[model samples]
Target: MPYLGLIVLVVMIAALIDIVSSDDALVRGLPRWAWLLLVIVLPLVGSVVWFVAGRPVAGFSGRVGRDRPGQASAMGFPEYDHPGRFVPQDPEADAAFLKQVRERAEAQRRQGEIERRRRVERERGQ
Candidate 1:
């Protein structure tokens, strides 16, 4: 019976790892409660199910960039069918993105103003 417990433990561990590492689509397709039940009730079967269907890619082995750790794939591909790259829901991050956009717009405005002044001065000199 001890061997059974060991197998269960390993299967549970595998299921947990598979769930955490996988993308949202995989998780959404199979509910968390279902996963919990699968892992708890039938260890080996659950682990096998998670391995086959829970993982993002079956045969994919390549990792993302060298600098970034735990990234999904190279060039940072989005796992889900979302329009944009997945960003964590953080107000501060949204504010920062807005600030960056505002700053770029301001820079462009300033450059336009400078060009206008230069043109005016040139006309006045002529």
Candidate 2:
């Protein structure tokens, strides 16, 4: 009888860990929190329910699942990929983007200098 209790405890622990580790996007049926509460409240039944309903089905790799081809790599969204490690697909487009950024910065710098000169002139006149 005591061993049966230990088995239930083990099952419940496994269920809890599975619930916690599963991605929110992959979780099916009830929300993760509700499933957690159910499992805590009714150990054996809740664990069974969780395995049957809440757990993500097989082959689910998260928001960036293997089935999704729009995403290039396993590093997550392309824009949010680690900086300095992002390899641009089109070098020509990347160069043009950099050129636009430099031009905009130069224009802003010129405007700032003109404003500074005007401010100095006003102070001198006063």
Candidate 3:
């Protein structure tokens, strides 16, 4: 009986932590604040409801399906799941990306210079 009470307490605490730490948008059904109230008001039942409905489903290896920029994997560490998640794994690809960025910056700088010169010319002509 004592052990049963302890188990319930543990489960309730775990559920509370999960609810508080979970992303607001990911929680389904009720709003996060309402869910918090439910859990606080009805520990065991609320915990069960949270697990069944509110909790975000863990992906393969416990990661969330939607990957946010700089968000860690479900394993609680960073993993480069997509090519854009981190720097290019291949050296050639990294170099190519850097070259493209440099070219873009140079083009913008040249365009700005041209615009500034045109503005100056227009002002002088006026």
Taking the tens digit of each residue's C-alpha lDDT, what string does model 1 give over 16-120?
777766555435447766776776687888877877766555544332222334544213333322423344466476556656776898999999999999999
CA shift of 51, model 1, Å = 0.8
- Estimated TM-score for each candidate: 0.39, 0.49, 0.48
Write candidate 3's Cα lDDT for 1-126 as tens digits.
769878888988999999898877667788889888998898899999999999865542423344575664323323333322333346476556666776898999999999999999999999
What's the number of clashes in each of the models?
0, 0, 0
lDDT of each: 0.63, 0.76, 0.73
Q: What stretches of model 1 exceed 4 Å from their correct place? A: 27-29, 58-126
Against the hidden true structure, what lDDT does model 3 obtain? 0.73
Task: Supply candidate 3's per-residue lDDT for 58.
Answer: 53
Please give the TM-score that candidate 1 achieves against the real structure: 0.39
TM-score rank order: 2, 3, 1
In Å, residue 63's CA in model 3 sits off its true spot by 11
